[model samples]
Target: MSITPDKAQRIAALAKLAISPDQAIRLAAQMDDILGYMDTLNSLDTSGVEPMYTPVEHVSVLRPDVMRQDISRADLLRNAPETNGESFVVPRII
Candidate 1:
């Protein structure tokens, strides 16, 4: 998982970041360490462990959907700038 300065430079280019040669050298070393640590973590066994999406428990706070007709279709159509006695007429984009 060793990171070379050239690889670091390429990584920086991909991220749209500009770095000097000295910065690239430093970045290579830092990235090497990070990758080494990730390799160590990957060596662990978690066969029986359950996968979790988040560390904390979460609950839905959304309101339930209900069907109700408050406004009539003719009333809604009357407010439109342009319509063929149906939906609002919008400018063609495609």
Candidate 2:
């Protein structure tokens, strides 16, 4: 799982990133260290441990969905400085 300079250069190219030769070498070393740490973690034993999805033990409480009266379009448009017949008018992006 070691990352070499050539592999790092290839990864940078594939990701469309511009990196110097010195940066490529440094990135490769860092990636190798990360992989080494992951490998070390993989060596740990967790045979009977229960997997935890969250730190706290509590059920999620959610309100039941119910329809409510909505505001009229004219009421909503009254506060806007600029708006179309059905929606707010915004500046063109492109």
* Model 2, global lDDT: 0.89
Model 1: residues with Cα > 4 Å off, grouped in runs: 48-50, 63-94
Candidate 1, residue 76: CA error in Å? 32
lDDT of each: 0.90, 0.89
Off by over 4 Å in 2: 6-22, 66-94
State in Å the error of residue 26, model 1.
Answer: 1.3
12-88 per-residue lDDT for model 1 (tens digits): 99999999999999999999998888887678898999998787676866777988899988899997899888788
The TM-scores of all predictions, comma-separated, are 0.51, 0.44
